[model samples]
Target: MPNKKLTDVEKLAIVQEIEGGHIGINAAVRKFGFSKSTLMKWRNRYRLYGMEGLAIRTCNRSYSAELKLQAVMDYFRGELSQYQIIDKYKISSRTQLADWIKKYNGHSSLRAYNGGKTAMTKGRSTTWQERLDIVLHCLANGQDYSQAADQFKVSYQQVYGWVKKYEAGGPEALRDGRGRKKAPEELTEADQQKLAMRKLEYEVERLRAENVFLKKLQEFQRGRR
Candidate 1:
């Protein structure tokens, strides 16, 4: 941590006030936030350097995000184990490595982002098929869009939108959606069962991937098998 800025003149005046014949240092601590040890340091510095006693200073700890991420990535690429990376990188915490690896893959190296200078990303909009699945689930249960949004933490507009899309197009509404017109729900109960099964089957794969990551210190294996 960096020291709070203080001027040489202010430090000298404080030193004089502490050393004044009529007052002791404890009274001064009450008037200012300085500790007794800080006052002592000021006194010693003043005696040695006269008016040049105050200057910016830092304590010993420095945490670097880039260095830690690089070490974590190296560990993931089979170059280092979790503990080995910690020792090699002089990382502040072992868990930090685990977290980065879990998030970014086996090689969770830090990548610099010229974030402010970067233009907005294009063509990566949310999938409407994904939207329709959740909306149908809500509608089949007779739940309102607001209630679903609250449960899922999406904006109200989004929740109602899926509801509107599903209402207009039936099952096909939940898709890489087309124009605002309804699509025919020509499928029978057997077909609807197959569609529902597709969603459930995909869900199983997602959970399995999550389980792999949460189980231990291992490389992430995402996607459905």
Candidate 2:
């Protein structure tokens, strides 16, 4: 069902009906208004781990880098398919496993997954310069908003909004712009020097980001070949 949250009991009932031969997969799909893939997923999970497998995830699950590496190695061993690996590892989804495989094949580092629900309702205050830096950092690191937020100790929404604003209207758009800003000509020699130094620092950071992106791109290309 689209956007439907099926209770554990309901999910069990549906899987039982299908398993007991009371309802065929196609018939269940038609009656329950869920895709065949979803129904099959439920059935397989129920079969593999009983009720526990069918339980809805209340929070995001973290996988250790070691577990990810093992899963990747198992797949490469060719003894099990992706679905089999997922079931064996109790992974949350095919997509999650697929991501690991892709990263592994591309020779990217597989770090422990510690992501979920990091966005805040209220964002903290930031200066225009800080906003610009945050946006630049986010873009440099594959536009990972949550990572940028955590690193900068800002809200995810703030980082995201700043990036979008910067994208649409350059660095000037990041400025609060509500107050009068000093013109370039109005800056003292020391102020100008500081600005120049900051620009140089940002440029170095951007170059590093670009180098990392290029390396990742090359890795993926090599993987495809």
Candidate 3:
């Protein structure tokens, strides 16, 4: 696993501090903000392999798509927590594993996740239907604007704006406004009622789908057990 490049003298000092019995390992970790496992790994390497093992190596390493998928599957199978998987696989960062899991669950392509290549980032305009779908999906998943932005590969401001517009005007609010004079922001009482009705319909549909998915997931878990 790649670590921040520390000088040889700094590495030896840290190892000495831990070994000198002047401070507990937990105190050293709290003071340095280093992971316990990381500190232990460094200490062991310094002891067994001398100063060379503690030396910073090249940071560039690549994991194949299949390997990433397998790691995610092992995580979901309840075999180990993310930190444990990191230690087991000698992964550099837990966030890398998390990104893999997110892509797998979202059914997004590896290239899209790694390259941040998405329709929203490719200069393709979104239709009202697409906007509505994104908004509803975010709401259904109980995602805040930031999480929605990451999951949907849109800007945080875009998700925030869409949600505000959706709450005020429902589906009609998402319609393209290009080359058209802006309408008044105020909605009539009847329009407000229609918006509320449409929002309720969206909520009901999302709940129904969630229920079915949960049932199927439970059945699958039972079969696995």
Using lDDT as the measure, the top candidate is 2
lDDT of 2 by residue, 1-225 (tens): 778889888999999999999999999999999999899888877877799878997775777765676676678668999889988988877778888778766656566758423233236789887887788778867787767877887755577778887787766677786876555576688866866676677678878878888999999999999
Task: State, as a TM-score between 0 and 1, how close model 1 is to the true structure.
Answer: 0.26
Determine which window of 10 residues in candidate 3 has minimal summed lDDT: 115-124
Residue 88 displacement (Å), model 2: 2.1
Positional deviation of residue 166's Cα in model 1 after best superposition, in angstroms: 1.2
Which lDDT tens digits does candidate 3 get at residues 1-225? 345667767877888899788777788788877778777767765665577657776653456544565466568768798767766665555667788778766766544324443322111367766677778767866745545665666654467678788788666678887664335356567866755775687789779978999999999999999
Which stretches in model 2 have alpha-carbon errors above 4 Å?
A: 114-225
Instruction: Please state every model's RMSD to the true fold in angstroms.
Output: 17.6, 13.2, 11.3
What are the per-residue Cα lDDT tens digits for candidate 1 across 1-225? 226656777777778887775557887777767877677667755554466445443442334434534454367458666656665765434455566556444333233332222111111245655575557556644545445544554533466556776676666666664566343566677867877886676567556756766865343344332
Model 3 residue 202 lDDT score: 70
If the candidates were sorted by their lDDT against the true structure, best first, what order would they fall in?
2, 3, 1
